[model samples]
Target: MTASTEGATDTAATTDSGPTSLDTGSETGHQTTAGGDTDGSKPDLGAAPDEHCANPGPWPLPEAPLLELPRFVAHSYIDLDQIGWMTKFRSSVGHDYSDAFERCRSMKHYAYPIDEVDWGAVELYAPVAGEVIVVEQERYGSRVQLRSTLHPEIDFVLFHVDLMGPLAPGATIAAGELLGTHYGDQTYSDIAAATTVDGAWRLISWFELMTDDLLAVLQARGGISSPSDIIITQAERDAMALCCTNGQFDDPEELSDWVPLDAGNLAQPTRLGLATLDDDDGRLR
Candidate 1:
């Protein structure tokens, strides 16, 4: 639900208190480009024996993170604007990654935590220094895409933002620079990254490329303790049954689409987060 729709209160409502579950409907035509494995039949979910599964390259790729992880939000916790409670990968609380890159792909990208702060109180910043290749203006807001200067294949994406500068295909951007203000009505920031592989864009959590110091900031502000605590591996996510309907990638169900953020309690009977979750008990939808 990070990509705010104009009026989807029915499906995008805050049924509970963690992150808003989504109902993409036709509003997400912009993000409908999930390729590689969208044949309606769910992936093996096991070890992904087939070859079509997404290929996640080495972590912290070289020339990677050409710049430090830029701060996306400008709010401070000392001011009572609690900007925490972000959902990790394979957790469908943001956009639907039900059918991401390849069979073994986790369509999910990280949603930067911005809970309880005024909508535009937080300013957005570029997390990487690269060349702007795509700048899109949508009904709700603007989105920008940048390719790494060092590694052209790796792309950094930011959605649901009102761009700050005159960005075009050939423009250059430095990490930590102001991208724009937090647009729309959602509580968090959305960043879904991908890499070009075999003529297709394969989903890859950009945070996986973060330096140790960068990840430490995530651990300090949110409920995260370790890298594994946040990232939902293919096997772990499949076991949780956090999937979407055959063709419905946007209309996320409470249990089916979203994964719980209980960092260490993977096998707990019920899932929990920083705040109290609804009594839904997280039954597989």
Candidate 2:
């Protein structure tokens, strides 16, 4: 449980020689200074303080899936903008470029907005039924990493973890399981990069939750109006079950066939294409 450190008042001697005059304000028990303007009244220097409140318990865990495993992971980024561009450019071009690039790729640093530290105050959950892969606690920040066999190609990383205590490495965890809470100088409320459409950085996990077809079902029914909504029809659920049971299709083009239900005459699935990630100089942007 987290504990709040509030309500404590410091007792400092205003004067060593004389009795200080006290002024009571409009509200009961709340006092202000006399001769002070109504617009700017000084707060009461002395008052019985309220006790600190205990932290609330953890949130209830989500139900597990019967067939396909769920994969959960939190995301965060360093405030690169705080550092000078020359430093960043030097780091990128220096002999340590390989190490820097590896770190950038592992954490997707380029995709992260330099202006803000994402996922600061929010709690992240496990994406899949996997064992804790890594746990490191040092001055930089605390980290709780997990891996699941459900998705071999993907490695779920939850960085910038702030926990009550150090989580043990190699611990077994289920989907929707509590990995850790947000910590350090980073937070979810940080302002997004200048180039981003929204001024606020997104605290959402990057891992994909549902297949493209299941997403199509939700889209056709207009069920997923918000990011929080996960409602789907029985047929959509059945399609997902078949996909997981039969194992994902080998051919990328044939993957659409795994979708069990068809929303006849529905609009074509939205296409999201990516352009080159390079500039005029043929270097990564």
Candidate 3:
């Protein structure tokens, strides 16, 4: 996750603590500001009430689809334990997986069953119309990690990838463009509090402002209705259900807050920093 410059200061006093002063002088010449005073004379910065600080206000939601249609369809969802809690909360709050699986099974569309691995070739495509933000070529022994800024308000993260070579940063890409391929042993692991059926590996990706629209879609589709319901498969549903039931998912509010706006529609690429996988080698365990 990238850092935001809005709240980057060190000594900005919050409502709960009042104005905080930073001493630039030596230890012997240290000075202090009273909790209420910005200057020595004024009782406060004339700052708004505490509620202003407590509730930053509702975040703006995107109108049109932030990401292009036919987005890179994952054969399965990333195991819940591999991502932040908010992602898990988003998946759980809007949908019931077990019930969805039963419904899918009744309809005989359960080709991708739990306890089985998706050995089928995994496809990779761009999530939005933007440039490559960052690409890490050597992180996972030929795997590449791509980060792109789809819009001024949204950042997209694609990992567990196998690319041809290093993609220059700032190279623009259209939505649904072939970004890379998926590579790894087609088995998952059962470590770090995440559940695994037999041995199917999971992948990790991050999204900023793009989630609200995705959530809205999932909600409209009855929250993970089935493996073939939309983007997720049956195995993915079972894995998330198990992870949520076992307390492996992160907090919902935090995840919801991290979503950014899908403005700008920028197409820039950045360098991949550290690659965070479920296990050390992008395997289950």
Candidate 4:
């Protein structure tokens, strides 16, 4: 599907800490068109994807309540190769397949499933503590972008979502603060995060960062661990390997703040970065 924009009022909010920083030293430039629509008429900053899924695996609904931590699923690059997480497609029907995939990869688009039975507009919370920088509206849709003050180079953009109650292009928002919700039959929303590097916006993979964060929290959520248990399953390793690709990540061990599954009986090492949103004074530790 295509992207459009709508109008919104500006507001302000406090910021929080996540690994929101980006390597701003790259030479590529990124731009988002007004109304969040980019077509053949505009210069190609990069082709953005529709969604990112971070859920480790699906859960039986009746048993979901028994799960300690929330399961993550967002828009992610579809692994056509079936061998790893990164996209290896080199050709398509007629378009520049490799180029398009790379562009989509760079954007790190996130798509989460909406409850079809009760899926309508609901409030969106600030994923980070940051200030509103740009609110763009077009004839068909709208977008709001935020820049984390704590990590000035990191930016978050919510697409096809409306703003409500006096929000606009210059507001500051606290992490988990309310933003308006979807107003139509759409099943999902899109969120794109990037960091400005060398004057260009570089997208970071949200899967590793998000999954690792959830792992940290879940490790402490329940009392279900054995001193000799194998923490990192082979499936989890493949998923992590797939989620991180290109120059984005060479080794999962090198990923920042990542908690290794096997750490020699280190009790809940992942929880090291777990912190409450209200505890804004501390970083995700």
| lDDT by candidate, in order shown | 0.43, 0.27, 0.27, 0.33
**Which candidate, 1 or 3, has the higher TM-score?**
1
TM-score of each: 0.57, 0.30, 0.33, 0.41
Candidate 1 structure quality by residue, lDDT tens digits, 82-168:
333345665645333422122222344433333345656567777767787667664445657676665555666666577766778
lDDT of 4 at 284: 9
| Candidates 3 and 4 compared by TM-score, better number | 4
TM-score of 2: 0.30
Give per-residue CA lDDT, model 2, range 1-285, as digits (tens). Answer: 121112111111123321111110000111224345577754443322211112211111111122332323222222222211111111111111111101110111111222233434345456456666556553334545454546532334444456645567568877666655455332111111101011111111131344454344335544233222322222232233211101111112111211112234233222211101110001110
- Candidate 4 residue lDDT tens string, 107-157: 323222222322234455566667887666522235567766565556666
Worst 10 residues of 3 by lDDT: 100-109
* lDDT score, candidate 4, position 151: 58
Better of 3 and 4 by lDDT: 4
Q: What is the lDDT for 135 in model 1?
A: 72
Worst 10 residues of 4 by lDDT: 91-100
Give the CA lDDT, 0 to 100, for residue 5 in model 3. 26
**Per-residue CA lDDT of candidate 3, range 165-211, in tens?**
56666677666677555444332111111111111111222321234
Query: For this target, which candidate reaches the highest lDDT against the unseen true structure?
Result: 1
